[model samples]
Target: MSEGTAISDASASRAASSSAPLAERYAEAMIPVFGTPQRVLVRGEGCRVWDDAGRAYLDLLGGIAVNALGHGHPALVDALAKQAPQLAHVSNFFATEPQIELAETLLSLAGAPQGSGVFFANSGTEANEAAFKLARRHGGAERPRILALENSFHGRTMGALALTSKAAYREPFAPLPGGVEFIPSGDTAALEAALAPRDVAAVVAEPIQGEAGVRPLDPAYLRALREATRDTGTLLILDEVQTGIGRTGSWFAHQGVEGVVPDAMTLAKGLGGGFPIGAMIAFGPEVRGLLTAGQHGTTFGGNPLGAAVALAVLGTIREDGLLEHVRTLGESFAARVLALGDPRITEVRGAGLLRGIGLAEPIAPQVAAAALEAGFIVNAPDPSTIRIAPPLVITDQELGSFADALPALLDAAAPAAAGAAAPVDPSAAPAADDKDPS
Candidate 1:
């Protein structure tokens, strides 16, 4: 059959056996925030997944960096299976051992100072919600503003949305919490000016803006924010939701970058390896007492199932030395892709497994579609930026497969859609960096 005929047949077959009825059910039952489903992923394993149609894909996006251990790792599976049969959940009124253990583990990894406290939530958005509330508790009547960076993404919840810098995400939900100001990321002058107001509660930033396509803030800028916030009695909140858990080849992206320490930090995404969990870890004694017993809580936060799964993911990352693995694999993967020397690839930027390939032309969406047809899964954050945050456990062989396929993917995305073309100016007009400040 002809290529066009085959394509039409596949479309018709998909429509005939469609999940559109379920989609219609969702349309009526759910809010139209995310729009139509992209793909109905049925099952996943380490570094790979299949759609409802059973099309195999090399999962390079890692569920947007949430599946740190990939899908269905033995350790995570065992933890969940064992914990579910034993005790799945309990009320927040009663403490659970897994919750406490996970809390201690997160606090320890964060390296918070003594008397630090932690609050658990179910998603990155909720983690930021707790952080926002904690910041407010610290600010009280004196300071109420939060200084965030432009081009930042911090989830869609009301408080987190308020802190996010994008007008498109925040404007639709108007009258959000006030006293928030936006500044250009890495712009020392703007950050200083914004935080200089004694009425500011905190300056929240992601060490590397993940949803904005893995843009890392300069070490010097982070250090400066720490000092600037300190001078004005404001708090420094680092939203490590996407950059944490070995995503940036570090236990935490902020570590070893600069001699800077945030007063509080929020983590999620890769934290649970797939299971949903999020945490807010407050450092030192500054905000420890800010929240009393009756201040805040979550019913499903830190449930035994999630906590147990997270514990296993953390242990596996340590025991398997996934951090060093991510560091090495990331460097090699990046080098190979950059060496592709594709004209459309103007620049490549990332840390560890989370990287973004910037295209000279607006063709990332097409490139991603091409990649899917090629049996790989990748994501396009913008028309010009292809974001890759593969599982930290992705093997070298898998990385090579992607590297081998990349030149073809780029060719398929470029003008002729085949064979290598002459390299374009690497210094071509580049897309502006997407910064996340929450």
Candidate 2:
């Protein structure tokens, strides 16, 4: 039988056996990590996905900002198909052309100066771990503390977890790597005070805080941070895992702001369109060589398959001029949503394709469920925020449909109370899980 036929038969057999029910099958076969599968998504094309029951929904979350080119773009498919059979995995002892090319491409896109380097990893967490090690190496023994913002999120690994500010995520995983401090996100004074002593090895920040309801740090504050860190000799690390790769109308979100560059930047999410790939791009000799040899490694970090896929993703973004497209569409979409003037929608936050709708009450979970039922998929990162990081390929018409549907969705989620607020009980809002769709 052909390879396609064999795969089809395998999928048929698995689906036949799991007729017991989607939830039951998941419960029996998988760990209770993500609570429950939101939907048994079976197929996708462009910005739309289909569930097993044949329901279609507009995918606004874009796999939490990982699907830059959207589901199964021809370029991405061609790249994976051409590269996988030829050279998929080779140990780190040897480097492939695609791997080297990808590294060069990322550095070029980041506009890093000479003597810069990159460390590849499989996820955002690993990339952040590498950055953490670089910070420690640069700081030495005396300046040990690593500083991150109050509403920031790096990743889930031990070192990255230490830098994350959410109590619920960090408290459970206590005794984590020490020497991490949390400062307010947009407070330049607080940052200056924290870095005044020069005891900080690094100051890590997300140009836009994704998990904390898509809060963007003020650009002036970021410039101030650059100045403060420079004066104190502290490294500035930007976590662009969710905001990079043309998602925010630039190669990196920090680039949208003027005259602010980081010592190191962590990128993953959309770097490979949908394939898993992460990288830490360190600028200057001081930050680049800190890792050295044998300090850190990953078996599948920069494999030929991922590298080829990432190169294709980058090429597509550049050739298609998606950066300008995202900026235009994003501004229009945000304006349309805000113009609805729904009482429930308090504010619309974020830039480019990454957006968050802040609600007047804590009914985000209900709003999300209502949206799902209304043939749309969105994320409630917090109890009162709805985040929309749709595929860059999403068209203006598709976004308009969601915008037209927003007011009704909010009404269905919570009927407006003239003087009373929506019920705010513990059970009313579910705790956000590890798979943060930020």
Candidate 3:
């Protein structure tokens, strides 16, 4: 189809659905991967989004940490507008300036040593998939085993899925690529035992396991992991998909821990400020040389448009000092939630904007629903964990609004939770395990 014809057809589809309930239209026209989106968002402007009914919501979830600058920020908008007309996409056979510049900036931010490199993809799962390939190539015939943390989330693609430890997301797809094992996260002895055989190719983990209820691994544990992996010749790959690009008040979440650097790092979510970009950075010469040329590639991986937008996001974060702002506001916001003295709220777990509000009972779903009804956006990653990873540019007032309404939201949810929440299974393990606040 011609470009103009395709545009017209899309516009016609929008017009046909103008009067219909978007939820019904969505159900009819789309697959239910996400089990029916809660709201049909029409548009957004800096920390707020509007539904089809014209109701506005404070977007505390920030598109699940993809909208680093919130919505429709001028810098991001300008970058997209400028880049699209100039040069949007090019085949991987030819390189673009934006792609080169973006890769360079990422390498610098990561503090990767000389001979480091980056491979770009279009989403979090794709980035993890690339990292998976890198791991396999490095392992080759000598080391075939891979280690991932229990309850950790990486991504959903086949290769990435193999590394993810969530049973629900993995069970249906098996038998996945073998030689991947789940070990207890943060248990030094378990990790040591896993590596003692010297057959494990790599260990993949998230600095903050966002989908596992925004849980942040201990810095000391991370340091030990790095040391042990180095000693054993295993690659330490940190999945920073949700916590990178100032989400956790740092360029990368692990940067908060001194003298700790992974052999490979995967990034996505907020990297392009919602522009659908992902990257895998290989540190040092040996790791960088893993996948030579034809071993792996993607058609849309390093498109100029995505690279330009990501550069804009990084530049904006640095220029506006959103890192420090995120740190200060996140601390204050967590404190405010705790100070509310609501019994339903157990404690806030995580750092910076990436946080999970621990609950006394399995009422997180009801609470998230209540928050949505009360014009705030949040989510329940698990039965007892309310995960909130708002935009880095979100202000004190924006967050304060949610905190002020949280008590009432909880009150609204109490009745529903009492009737609808699943009873805690005494024999089964807790879904969240309180997410280890310490």
Q: For each candidate, what is the lDDT?
A: 0.83, 0.89, 0.89
The TM-score values for the models, in the order shown, are 0.88, 0.91, 0.92
What TM-score does candidate 2 reach? Answer: 0.91
TM-score-best of 2 and 3: 3
Off by over 4 Å in 1: 1-31, 415-438
Over 244-276, each residue of candidate 2 has an lDDT whose tens digit, in order, gives 999999999999999999999999999988899
lDDT of 3: 0.89
Candidate 3 C-alpha error for residue 123, in Å: 0.8
The digit string of per-residue lDDT tens for model 3 on 139-257 reads: 98999999999988888889899988888889999999898999998899999999999998999999988888988899889999999999999999999999999999999999999
Cα lDDT of candidate 1 equals 0.83
Cα shift from native, residue 255, model 2 (Å): 0.4
Cα shift from native, residue 49, model 1 (Å): 0.9
- What's the best-to-worst order under TM-score? 3, 2, 1
Alpha-carbon runs more than 4 Å astray in model 2: 1-17, 415-438
Point out the higher-scoring one by TM-score: 1 or 2: 2
List candidate 3 stretches off by more than 4 Å.
Answer: 1-19, 420-438
Instruction: Name the lDDT value of residue 222 in candidate 2.
Output: 92
